[model samples]
Target: MKRTTFLLVFGVILSFSQAQLDTGGEETGGEEEHVELFTTPATKMGAATSDFGYNLFRALASQEAATNVFLAPISVSAALTQLSMGGSEQAQRQLFRALRYHTLQDPQLHNTLKDLLASVRTPGKGLSTAARIYLSRRLRPKQDFFGLVEQQYGVRPKALSGGPKDVTEINNWVSQETGGKVQRLLTKPLPRNSGVNTVSAAYFKGKWVTRFGQSGAMENFQVDGGVPVRIPMMQQDNYPVKMGADSDLSCTIVQIQMQDDVSMFVFLPDEVTSNMTLLEESLTAEFVQDLSMTLLPAQVFLSLPALRLSYSTDLLPLLSDLGLSDWLADTDLDKISTQSAKLASLNHKVAMETVPEGNQYPSAASSAHLSYRVDRPFLYLIRDESSGALLFIGRVVNPKDLMI
Candidate 1:
């Protein structure tokens, strides 16, 4: 039996005070406002990696046009960043450029990554990220390289035993790290002459800050071409959300809050059959950050389908399209081992689910008038509000395609 790889990437948001909502046409007693800028290394690194994440998403979306695409961009970046630590200068330059970190200096990049990883893995956040470097038993990695990865990334390199048991061991590790949401990451044995293999995984199980009422009824979800499929849809009246519209992309954006400072931004096209090319091309870390600040607070009737999705794919081809084909074809990881070694494989898997659960009950005092329904294909992203890192990004072409 061929075991399939399971990957998922999604996000959540936290509720905010109505005072923070920019309700247009509101005037308060004139008061001065002060704003503090976040120019920390971790934030800078997050912005850079997020750009790479958007690039990766577009590449995948361009290929799989009407199919669902989900991935943890930060996880993939972490895995490749670790690999670059063991690469020669030339290889390092190529990898860093592909990751959109060419401008960042050394040592600082690694240090910032350490800080960013720590921030995202805070306990009780319902989010976790992990990475590992699997080396062949026959090869001996440099002690300095080994120590840096373990100390900085929090995972020591594991020597592959070159046996069927390696598969079980790797799968078990992935399962444990992802809280059992992702399992059997390695369905087959490691490839022959496998010099280095990297695995990165992220898992999120988010609860809404304001939970929706589930009616236990299936509703018709309009896919491309206006075709409809029945699926469970969660509804909430007077839902408090930060909403905005972008005429350039011809989409309406809504921000939903989940627990633990995570915000899920939904981009819904005006029509069921609207082309997503323009919207997809407009995604970037800066674009999202700027858009978030511009949204106004609104009370509206909201309907969304509960999602449980997992996705897995080889990243070499996608990276190649991003101008890293030469590095993928012939790597120079001289710093990793005395023997010439190249990357054997780079695979990423993620699993995420959003249920109709929340921290508090709905308020009945809502004076909502506007309505927003997610009954069609749309794009979404999960971001860590505190660190400004994108935990997950995906396109939901059809909710019924991968239910549970």
Candidate 2:
């Protein structure tokens, strides 16, 4: 049998919740400690848990603290969890804590992920989650890791000589998985003599329940503390959406539904300037959960940026700051074939678009339409509708910000 070691190092960027427990959580918890990731009958509690994980990551990865930062917390979590299959004990602990699940101590976490992936991937879902491992020609991981990686995670390892060909192959895989939304993941040359590589990706093409007009008009938007510029604002009048104001952060919160039980939450601060700091500080899991509970459904006019955006990030330093420095520096890969190697790179890329509504909608009269228009800098989250699990979190200050 060939010994195989995993190179669970992934670099991805581009992409971008809730449900009923229908999972029977209480029965399992009483007899076993396997805190079913699906811990409730209604996807709400589990969704709440997943949303918290995303927030924890957002807190750590916000490099431009006050600028336009976008990410799929779900993508980040999935990528790290995929890496955990090959991590040492200490590394697993650190990764768990960073993901806000350190104390749960669930033995079935990975298995739960397997089940969740299966349920979410179906016909016409409009969302895709994928994982791939590319092993260096010279390195062979232990047999068990290879088997588990494929059997449980649904990822098949592709062996390639690490060079220009492998780079193109890896990027091509990402492009195919994301339906060509993401073009290239590895723009820079790969580190020579590397033994492993990993890639985790998510892609979602959200179709609006109530479509916006195809041709949007240019409107003035406030970005970066009082600077005004014209950006195309996708418009839909009398859009039925949930709305609320969060006093804790003085931000207005809006939630709009997409197909397949997914929703988008927008956080617009009352005061345009100096509020992002407060808004970021207050965006905790508890805050999100409370907002989900309190938001009331209403009719309003909605205007959001009609631009496609993509981001690429070098995540090693950020991961280090989130308490994984030791794992990166003194990694123990005894679980895999004892091929000594450190995490070469962790990059992420995501592409997201707010497309216009499909059919012409008759204008419905509603007073809320006069007041609710997102014409300035704000934060947005796309998530599961019932569970409120975050799939993507991003800030929009410039419509052309990192257009991919």
Q: Give me the runs in candidate 1 sitting further than 4 Å from their true place.
A: 1-38, 105-107
Clashes of each: 12, 42
- Model 2 over residues 1-404: C-alpha lDDT tens digits? 11111121111100001121123233322323323334443343345346554554455436666566666656566666766777788877767776666644556777765665655554344566556666667666777877877777776666677678877988888888788877787786567666555665666667777787634688888776556878788876677766666555677778877777777888887766523765665555445655554455555667777757877665556766556677777756555556875666666777777778643363566434234678777878776755446667777776645576
Task: List per-candidate RMSD values in Å.
Answer: 7.6, 10.4
Candidate 1 whole-model C-alpha lDDT, 0 to 1: 0.78
TM-score of 1: 0.88
The alpha-carbon lDDT assigned to residue 53 of candidate 2 equals 47
lDDT of 1 by residue, 158-267 (tens): 87889889989988998898878887777898885789899888888877899887644688899887579998888888787878666656678888888888889999
Local accuracy by lDDT, each model = 0.78, 0.63
Q: What is the TM-score of each candidate against the true structure?
A: 0.88, 0.81
